[model samples]
Target chain A: MELFFQFVSNTGFYLADYRNVIMIVVGSLFLYLGTAKHYEPLLLIPIGFGILVGNVPFFKGFGLGIYESNSVLHYLYFGVVTGLYPSIVFLGLGAMTDFSSLLARPVLMLLGAAAQMGIFFTLLGALALGFLPKEAGSIAIIGGADGPTSIFLTAKLAPHLIGPIAIAAYSYMALIPVIQPPIMRLLTTRKERLIRMPELREVSKKERVIFPAVGVLLCCFLAPASIPLLGMFFFGNFLKECGAADRLAQTARTAIIDTATILLGLTVGASTQGDVFLTGKSVCIFLLGAVAFSIATASGVIFAKIMNLVLKEKINPLLGAAGVSAVPGSAREVHLVGQSEDPENYLLMHAMACNSSGVIGSAICAGILWSFMVGL
Target chain B: MYGLQAITAHNGWAMAFAGALIVFSGLVVLSFIISQLHKVLLLFEKKPVDFQNDLERPDIEPPEDKLGLSLPKQFPADIREIARLYKPLVEALGETFCLSELYEILRKNDFPHPHITLTALRESEILIPDGDGVFTWNPPTENDDNEKVEG
Candidate 1:
């Protein structure tokens, strides 16, 4: 009877705090968003479930928490901590990515570069908010809206902030459909949204094959710190475009990337314990992340409008909002918005050009931040 | 007061300007290189054939199927019969057809397998989906035309 009472007393119900309860509810919200809303299900489901697992209030000395040494979760989390998962994810992304749109319309690459205003501005915000430079740099990358890049930068510059930063980055990415349309609408007129882009010129096979090689060389020469992420990325693209390694390319994009994603998302989620995650700093990070993302989206759209003044053939400025590197998600959102304005306006391909360029641009920005902040 | 002090304590404005400049410079250089790649490849005498004109030629004969016949062999026999039945309608529709419009033509002509025929045409690379249930016919290549003449 005494033992039974002791067991009952030691249960999670007694051990759980208000913060733990809040985190678990937050996790459930993630699960709901992923499952019911179908918003980034591949990432959110694992992350949500991991949050539940992490917040269960197990004995700390029992090697149960993700941070505990010799724990299985710790072992899995090593990839995230060492930045292996993001690099591998980049490989998969490179293999699956079709850079034809970017190549066909080289000028749209500027929108991708211009959209990175969010990252730097957010960096300043984070610093002003009393974060150390490293922490600030890590926080600012959430603006780029590329989850892996955010993880990669945080792991390098501020490992302690990885959990909140990754969560914030991914939350914004999943909310692209919700968050972006308003900014796009606010920035552009109906006529501007309806402006149709000309058809993209065909990119030859030779051009496709040469791109990964030249791209790596050019990008890496400019930002050597980015070589780890960008190298794997371009190598994966080379595998796909070179025509000699179809099987390797297929495996990288499918099986390898899927495995890495599951591990990265779950470990990242599990890292966000109530004790680690429910701090004032975390709330600030989330707020700053939202601001950064909004600024990035706005900057892209506004820049496209500016560019329209110089060009003879006007571009649909809506494509510029796709420059924040949410991959096909942001591009798809741009298309949906354009379609709502003019059903015949097929901006998907042009938007994809901007979106893919955003991926490269953000990775470059992450490297720049890493170079500046890592040592300081 | 602390928050306000924190915001002003760093050289964020300078860093922001420099960072934006670097990103712009790097990508602009990349853009310039990519814009020149086609011209450079052309100089090396490895030019991609212009398919725009070839794709517009309605007078060119469609290639034979794997069975060495004039129609696609991979398609169901019923779909092939439907294609034969609606040849004039297809010619009139030009390069693209709406699935519903194609179905209407098939129904009016008393042909079967409108859905199956559409799917088969896509699989056979004769029709490319142009989104929104629209499909465009693939233009015959010079190689396809040469093969047709040889056969």
Candidate 2:
């Protein structure tokens, strides 16, 4: 009878609490959104499942929890902790990215740079909210709207806050369609939204091949700490453009990136254990993340408006909304909004140019943030 | 921890200001370089007429891609190079072309694997379908002179 009682006590039901229940519910919602709504399904599904697995109540020290040193989950998670998975993801992204649009319209890259102001502003905001500098930096990068970058910087600066920061970053990224449109509409006039961008020029093979080499040298020289992230990105792009390493480029874009993404998403989800994640700080992080995204979007649009004052070839200010590092998400959102205003306006390609630059901008900011912390 | 006190005490203001400046400058310089990438390629595209003194020379050597002639491995011909090389020929055959017509021209020019190279051009999107079993070449730009050189 006592043995039966002990067994019952050891089971999850007896040990489970309201926090665990809430986290499990949140995990289920992620699964539902991924399966039904298609909000970043590639990411949300694994993360959703990982969250459920993480929240399962168990006695500590049996090598079951992800935090347990000897656990298999921990072993898989070592990739995230060491920043390996995100780097691999970046490599794949670089190979897959067609920089032709960006090269065709170089001026749009400034929108991406302008958008990164969210990260710095949010850093100050987080600090003012009482988070330590390292923790604040991790929270600030949520503004970059880059999942891998958010994970990479958080892992480096404040390993403990990885769950909240990553969840916040990806959540906002998935919600780009929801979050960006209203702000984009509010910022730009109807005429600005309807403005059609000029056609892109054809980028030559020589120019394509040289960009990665030049880009890597300049970015790394300025932000030496960004080498790990930007280095892999440029290398993958080089393989694609060089015309000699197509096979390697195929693997980097497909197999390698796919593998890294699955691991990264799952580990990041599991890291959000209820007790650790359910905090005042987590709420603050979420609020700050929203603010960061809004600020970034606004900054990009405003900068484009500012640019139009000088240039004769007025840019469609909607392209500026794609300046956050959410890749196709922000770019697609910009396109949808533009189409809403002027059905004939095709802003996707131009938005993608800004989107690509946003990726570069965010990676640079991540490096700068890390260097600041290291200097301290 | 609240207001300017918190932001100032940790030097958040300085870091934020510096971070924003560096990223903006980095991107500005990068954009300037990207705008110049094609112009730089134009310089290399000019032919080396000094060495090719043989007026009767067949001119069979592949044009320099600006990466030098000696590659570590013998890879397939570049898509852009293939596109550039065949573009003028396709243009001569008029606005739209059937695959067989282009293949005939490549065969007359003694191009190795005319069939395979055409397939590659189609695959790389340099050749766009124009319906009725015909295709149109992509819009030409100044950079279209990727392989063309005047002797």
Candidate 3:
């Protein structure tokens, strides 16, 4: 009887500590948000569960291969911490992206640049609260609305702040449907939102091929620290969509990317240990992230309005909202809003161009921060 | 313990402060590069002799027989256009069923075992194999089709 009691006590099945319970509840929230609401479930579900597992008081030894030095996830996360995976993901994105919309109207890229203001502003806010500079920068990048970039940057600059930043980045990205619409409505008049853009001239295949190569060369030469991540991103994209490399494209988009995502998600989740994650600083980072994201959306829209004064042909200001790192999500939101104003309005392709530009812009922002950190 | 805590805290703060300055400098360089690239791209666009003229080509029409092109297979017009567009691939596959046949199968069933269909036809020993990498449709039992249909 005493032996049975001892076995039960030793077993980790029982919930024991308050912190464990809280973290488990937090994990369940992530799962529920992912499964029920379908909010960035791919990464959040794993991250949530990692939080639960890491917080299990009696299960300190249960590494689940995530923390194992030789594990696949650990190795993949080496790319994350070193700022490689997100950039490679960006490369795949670059390949998939069509920048013709922004090319047709070069002004939208400026909207993307303006959207990054949320990052700087949020960084200042985080710093004002006495968070370390690296942590503040990492937290601020959540405003960029790019998940992998957020994860990659946070892992490098502020490993301890990973949970809040990851959670904040994805949550805000998911809330694009919720948060951006209201701000977009408040900032732009119905007339501005409904403004019809001129038909975009079709971009040639040759130009498409040159865009990534040129973009990669330009950004890398300007900010060398951004090279590893941005270079791989553009390369992956260039390989995938370059018309001749169907096999390479198939591998990058499907097999390699899929495998990386699974490992990256799990390991990123594992890094969200409760002792490190459950802090006042983490909560503050979340609040600041929200501010950063909102500011980015507003800034993009405002910048577009400013450009409307300069350009002869009218530009739809709503598409400017897609300047955040949420990529298609923010882009789709802008497109939908435009369609609502005029059903014939097809802003999807145009919005996609700016959205992709936002991805590059955000990476450039991170690279800049990284250079500063390295004192280069 | 207090001294150690203070040192760690101080180190963390200093690192973060340094990080911000680097980020700002990096942003300045990036902005400059992007602006210059923008000017170059604009210059390239304005140069009419360059392939920039191709952007305004109105004579371009959708292909009449789109066979090999990776166009979106959304509509019957697109498929017809694909058929017209892919005339070269169709002519190249002369003796065998062409992309038109594949399109027919795909349109009907929404899927087809392309390799199986090709291999089965090849096994009947009537059609000549090109030996090149491109698979052409060559049905062996073409002569027997009338009798088989009549029966």
Candidate 4:
């Protein structure tokens, strides 16, 4: 019996360290959030499970280790850290966007520009908090609420901050349904909310075909840092709209993106090991992230209001708030809120224009950040 | 030898990791702010382009009548060009003797409306509603109500 007790005490099987137990619990929480709460589950579930598997303690009998340098996560991090995966994800995003609404009202492009104010103001705020300049920049990107762009930029400039910044961006994006409406209501009156946009005229197929190529050329020439990510993105979109490469375009948008998302999620999740997480600064980064997202949404709406004052024809100020990085869903949120107020308020196409332009705008923002970091 | 002391010792790597993440997030935020401010400042330098003038311009929007509705010649010309693309499906649906089936068949072919397809069939005296949920289509001048099966 004394020998048996010694065996149990010496054997590091199960709960060998209570910290691993806690980490497992945290990982399970992520799984619940993904499966039950359905919060970005495609990414979060794999990430959650990766965390769980990465933290599993003392499995030496299997002759395997938990997240050693040559582990599965290390290889996954290779793509994420090198900033290759997110750019491919961006290619899928560009294929999914339709910029016809923005082209119809080119002035709405200003809202896309204005919505980025959140990122800048939050940067200054992060800097004032005494963070190193590069670290502060990565933290501020959480305001954009665009996960891939945030990840791409942080991977280049501040790879260490990738986990927290990504978590912040995705978390706020999921919470947009909760976060955006209050700010939107506080700024706009019932009259403004009820303002129905006049019907948008159809864009010619010729224009649609031309828009993607021209957009890629112009943006690439202006901000070369944006080329690799934005270039593939527009190329995917151009293939889609060009009306000939349907098979290849469909495969890129659906199959390629779906595969990458799984690999990316697992990799990102595993990177958030207990040894990497559970810090005071990570909490601070999360708090700062919520602030940046709120400010960006508000700034976008305010710019639309400003535009209305200067223009004769009315635009729904709500669509402007959709300028943050969540793409069609954020824009759809604006439309849904407007639709709740008035069913006749069909702002989908208009909101889509701003939302799609945001894909370009945010990538450019990422490129600019990369350029500044590299001093290109 | 256990608990907090053990945790602190084990967590040296975590602390380093958190420090690195914080630094990276800070850099992205900084770049975003500078680039956006640059664009905003440049806006003032340009002449304020009038939204109304742009709105009034015909180049901005197509004629107002085309909202939500696709142009008539657009999908049809393309469909006829590739009618062979849908020929097998068309042959399959013709075997199903229900208006709902026919409605789906027409829609799959991108006929503008499902009702229009039924209406055209009725005007041509081809489809006769059999008082039940089903529809019987008669090839013109044929008297036999034959339930013919196609292999």
For this target, which candidate reaches the highest DockQ against the unseen true structure? 2
Compute the lDDT of residue A354 as modeled in candidate 2: 97
Reference-based lDDT, each prediction: 0.87, 0.89, 0.68, 0.69
Looking at model 3, residue A13 earns an lDDT score of 62
Clashes (N, CA, C under 3 Å) per candidate = 2, 0, 24, 24
lDDT of 3: 0.68
The TM-score obtained by chain A of candidate 3 when compared with the true chain A: 0.91
Stretches off by above 4 angstroms in model 2 are B47-151
Candidate order by decreasing lDDT: 2, 1, 4, 3
- Candidate 1 residue B76 Cα shift, in angstroms, is 32
What is model 1's C-alpha RMSD?
10.3
Q: Model 1, A180-278: lDDT tens per residue?
A: 999999999988998977657669999999999999999899888898889999999999999999999999999999999999999999988998899
- Report the candidate with higher DockQ, 1 versus 4: 1
Compute the lDDT of residue A328 as modeled in candidate 1: 87
Put the candidates in DockQ order, highest first.
2, 1, 3, 4
Alpha carbon lDDT at B116, candidate 2: 55
The positional error of residue B9 in candidate 3, measured at the CA in angstroms, is 15
- Evaluate model 2 with DockQ and give the value: 0.35
Model 2, span B12-119: residue lDDT tens: 999999999999999999999999888877766645543454554675876643322232233235566566667668888898889788887666655655655677
Tens-digit lDDT track of model 2 for A1-376: 9999999999999999998899999899989989999998988888888899999999998999899999999999999888899899999999998899999999999999999999999999999998889999999999999999999999999999989888899889988989999999999999899898765766888888999999999999999888889999999999999989999999999999999989988888888889988999899999999999999999999999999999999999888889999989999999999999875567888999999999999999999999999866
Please tell me which model should have the higher TM-score, number 1 or number 4. Answer: 1
Query: Which clashing pairs does model 1 show?
Result: A128-B6, A128-B7
lDDT of 1 by residue, B64-120 (tens): 422222434343344344445456666777777887877666544434445445666
Model 3: per-residue lDDT, tens digit, A69-169? 75554665676676666666665665566666655555566666767777876766676667666776788788789988888788778876666787778
Selected candidate, larger DockQ, 3 vs 4: 3
